[model samples]
Target: MEPQLSHHVEGAVATVVIRHPAKRNAMTAAMWRALPPLLEGFARDPGVRALVLTGEGGTFCAGADISTLQGSPAQAQTLAMAAEEALAAFPKPTLAAVRGHCVGGGAQLAAACDLRLAEEGALFGVTPARLGIVYPASSTRRLVSLVGPATAKYLLFTAELIDAARALGTGLVDEVLPEGELDKRVAELTRVLVSRSQLTQAAAKEFTDGRTDRDAHWAERADGNPDTVEGVAAFLERRQPRFTWSVAAPGSPSSSGSPSSSGSPSSSGSTSG
Candidate 1:
């Protein structure tokens, strides 16, 4: 099949598959451009409560197809950065389910997610150094935030692949599952994410990303919200809380009692060369 980003929603979760198996699912320029708009659509869809990013078959992404870097490298970099930012800014929970190799731009995409689940033998690296390319400042900062300055420097300087165990020890991934267990673990976590409150999740995402101006906005959202009430009532009754509050679409009034549409934030025709 031609390289593309394909997605399907199942019971409040959207799973996006990166298909470029011949290249270990490397993202091409077209694939990078395709991601932002695809994520925006999911963000606006009220039915989507969480998203899982995974590669088709055994491998995750190997990175951007470096052969495409020959001409107009600036434009290609711009597209990749845009895609990464879109994923990072997505209000709902997002997770990367990784297997095989996840290096370079692949690592950037995985780091952009709120959580990452990797298979035991998966290998990860940040490879701009190998190509004499300077990584973007934002990407570097994000990397440093995830795995710390020392480990980030080690990866960036050496361009060496780290095993999943080391990646986990250094905080590069949230979970490292046994072979054949990645999908099951990802499903379990995503279901838990779907059952939670979007109000809390959205606010926490912004705060964690270093946005300090939204405290009042979130305060208003929490005041008299049905989610808070239901949570309390459910706890008292010894039952699971049914959180109904969804993010409101941009410029739409946020309602406290029911699920509402959310404000926003792919596909390739297929890279790692």
Candidate 2:
């Protein structure tokens, strides 16, 4: 099959799978270009509480397809950066479920997610040095934030792959699991995320990302919101809380699905690249 980004929503979780197994799920330029719009759509959808980005088969992304980088390297880098930025800016929580090689652009995308869960034997590397390409400043900063300058330099300077254990120790991945437990753990965590308050999640995302100016804005949103009241009542009654607030950005289409709604999901795929 042609390489593509395939997505499907099940309840509150939307999963985007990278499918280019012939090249170990390397992303093509078109795939990189498609990512921002896909993430924008999910950001607008009230029903999408969480997102999972992963690769087809057992491997995560292998980076940009080398053939596409042979010419117009700058253009390819631009598209990859755009995609990484989009993923980083997505309002909802996102997790990268990694199992195999995550290198170059692949590592870029994974690092953009809010969290990363890797299989025990997965490998990770930032490989711009291998191709003699200068990594973007923004990406370098993000890598530094996650793994610290020392660890980030080690990977960037040598383009050497690190095992999942070292990645977890460096904070490049949040969790590392045995081979068969990734999907189950991902599902469990996403279900917990879906059960939480969007008001809390959205505000925390902003503050943690260094947006100090949004305190009053989030406070205003929290004020008089039913989620707080419901949470208290649920605690008193020893019942599960039902968070009702959903993010509906301006100019985006509205959906009937609320934070607690279990609406039927739909799937789509794009084979452009």
Candidate 3:
């Protein structure tokens, strides 16, 4: 089957799955082209508080579908870079639930996400060196930020496949779980993320990504928001806070509701591309 990007929402969390079992979820050029718009849709949905990126058939992405590279390598790289940037810019907290091979372009995608969780026995590498292709600067910077210059150099220079344990030790993956437990743990973490304030997460994400100038607006934005009031009240009352202040989309009416209480996000849909 052709590789595709698929996503579904459960409650306030969205899962974007890479599906191409015939090639161990290797990404096709079409799949790369499809990601930015799909992620934009997710960003515009106020109810989507967090996102999880994974792959079907028990594998994450193996890398780019090399067969497509025979036609136009530059096009493939450009599309992949665009998708990586979109994932990095997504406002909500994003996690990559990695299993099996996450190498080459697959590794680039994982690096772009805020966090990575891998199952035991999973493998990771950046194989541009092996392919005699230069890695993109943005991806290299993100990798260096995550694992530091020394380790980043090692991975890029050697193009060696590292196991899940090594990935975690090198700070590439935030956590490593047994195969059967990966999904449950990812769901649990994402649920926690959904229950928190989107305003706080967005601000923190921006600041951590080196936009310290945005810190000035954080206090002003937090001052009148109901999320702070509810959070404080819930803390005093010794109960879970019901955060209702969903971030409004550009030019859209602001809506408020307890995401935890709601069965799911207001919008729930899936598409393959």
Candidate 4:
């Protein structure tokens, strides 16, 4: 069966499931190509505030489907690049709810998300070395950005499968949960992410995504806006802030943000600034 990305919306959260469990949710070439559009759909959907990425059947992911590659190094690498581009460009807060065996390309997918939550016994590794493959530059840079060059080099060069605890320590996984508690923890985290002001989150993400690395004006362009002022007011008043998302809105005569009606913090993928 073909791999698919399924979405379910709950309040302000958009849960995206990687429903390719037969391959342990391993990414197929087609699945890699499908991510951007799915994410784009979520990016523009107002009902979605934050996105949760998880695999079906408790297994997070086993990376790319080697069988699909037919032992073609070039083909496998291409597939990885396709997946990398889409995840990296997703304009929202993305969380990876990971479970058993998040290794190889799966590890890279988790690394691409804004944050990651892993099951206690989940394993992580960059197995390119094991297969005599050269990792893509974007993935390599992202890994280094997360855990630093030394740690990135160690993981990539050794291809050792490390425990979830070590993955957390190395800045790979943000939080670790026991097998059964993963859902509860993710739910709580998702709630927190959705409740925050999207304005701040989006701008923060823009800069965080390294988009601001070469743009001196990015910070200035994103730090504050009308919605941010409203967020502050809402905080002081202890009321829900009415976020305006259109350029043609009552107070937002020139606004433009994803999720059209009003953007939740998730839409900012804030790394865009």
Candidate 5:
């Protein structure tokens, strides 16, 4: 059969599969070209609330399918960049269900997701430097913004293998599970996410997207909000930070006692910036 992107829906969650198992699920230029419209369809369809990205066989993604670029490097590069851009702009909350060998462009794919639920055996790296290619500026910035300068440089400079533990320590993967139970874990996460309100998810995503710049907006929210106050108060009280990041109308706080919840601070790096 001709290679194609596969998607199946179960309730409010949609699973998008990279179906070319013969290549260990390495992404093709065409597949990358198709993601934006696919994601846009999901975003506009009210029936879908969450999406999970994964591979069909035992692997996640190996990187770009170099074989596909034999005749068109320029086209391949353009397609890859647009894919990453679309993924970054995907409005709904996205999760990456990472399995074996999430390396190179695969790592970029996972990094594009809002959260990563990685299998224990999966590996991650940004391998453009090893291939004499420049990683996209936006992708590089996204990586740097997620793991900070030191860790991002360490990956890009070395192009070395990183395991689940290292990924967790460096804030790469959100959850890691044994190979046997990875699917179940992803399913559980999808179930929970499907129950959340779209407005809340979009707001949280927007607020996070705004933090990419070294600007005054991020500063004000992180430094001077009631959420920050309450979070700190809760921390001091030996209680959980009751993060109230809901989609209340502007100036109409969710609760009278808690004025506003500031955006999350610098340390908790999500998959996005």
Candidate 6:
């Protein structure tokens, strides 16, 4: 069966599932191509404030479908890179909820997300070395940025699969939960994110992603935004802030599935695995 990307939205959280259970959720070329549009939809939907990426059948993703590689290597790589970049650039916060194997391209996709929450038994690796394939420099840099150069080398050079504990220790994953607790934890976290100020999250995301310089313009832009006012007022009142900022608008260009032009945080494209 062909692999697929399934999207489900409830309230402010969207869940993107990668399904290819026959091969432990290995991503097919078509699935890679499908990601950008699906992610675009979520980004434009003001109702969706956060996203959770995971794999079907208790496994995250094993990587690119190797069977398809012999047919169209270049196309496969190009599409995969495009999807990776889209995930990285998504304006809202993204979390990778990993359960089982997350290797090769799967590992790259997880690395692209803003945060990763893994099951204690989850396994992660970057296996291009084992396949005699060159890992992309951009991805390497991201890995280095996460785990530092020495640990990045240890993973890439050896192509060894690391357990979730080791992954967390190396900074590969942000959190590790017990076997059955991942979904609950992720859902709770996304809910918190959704209830917070979108304006503040968006600006913080841009700065942390290193896409914007700190300047007076940031302060200028926030001077009278409703979110800012509500946040401050709520703090003074000792009550939870009801943030209402959203990206959706009638006739907004984003609604048509075009890339947003609002200078929102965008993903840095992924390097081919």
The best candidate by TM-score is: 2
Q: TM-score of model 3 relative to the true fold?
A: 0.91
Q: What is residue 242's positional error in candidate 2, in angstroms?
A: 0.7
Q: What is the C-alpha RMSD of each candidate to the true structure, in Å?
A: 4.2, 4.2, 4.7, 5.9, 9.4, 5.1
TM-score of candidate 4 on Cα atoms, chains taken together: 0.83
For each candidate, the alpha-carbon lDDT, in order, equals 0.86, 0.87, 0.84, 0.74, 0.72, 0.82
Q: Native-vs-model 1 lDDT? A: 0.86
What pairs collide in candidate 4? 92-269, 202-270, 205-270, 205-271, 206-270, 206-271, 206-272, 206-273
- For model 2, residues 1-273, the per-residue Cα lDDT tens digits are 788998988878999999998999999998998888787777767778889999999899999999999889999999999899888887788999999999999999999999999999999999999999999999999999999999999999999999999999999999999989999999999999999987788778778777788788778777888889999999999999998777754422222122332333345556457
lDDT of 1 at 90: 81
| Residue lDDT tens for model 4, 1-273 | 457766667866877766676788887777777665566666666566678888877788888888767767697678678666667666567899998888888888888889999889888889988878889999999999998999999999999989999989989989998779999999999988777656556656767876565244434534576676787799899998876442223433221233433432243221110
Tens-digit lDDT track for model 1 on 1-273? 677888888888888889988788989998998887678767767788999999999889999987789998888889899999989988789999999999999999999999999999999999999998889999999999999999999999999999999999999999999999998999899899999999889889988988888789889888998899999999999999999887744442332212332443222222221
Best by lDDT: 2
Q: Itemize residue pairs with steric clashes in candidate 2.
A: none
lDDT of 3: 0.84
Q: For candidate 5, report its TM-score.
A: 0.76
Residue-pair clashes, model 2: 0
lDDT-sorted candidate list, best first: 2, 1, 3, 6, 4, 5
Over 4 Å off, model 1: 248-273
12-128 per-residue lDDT for model 5 (tens digits): 677788777778877887788777666665554556667788877778888888897788877887788877767766656789998888888888888888999888888888888
* Poorest stretch of ten by lDDT in candidate 2: 252-261
Candidate 6 local accuracy as lDDT?
0.82
lDDT for model 4: 0.74
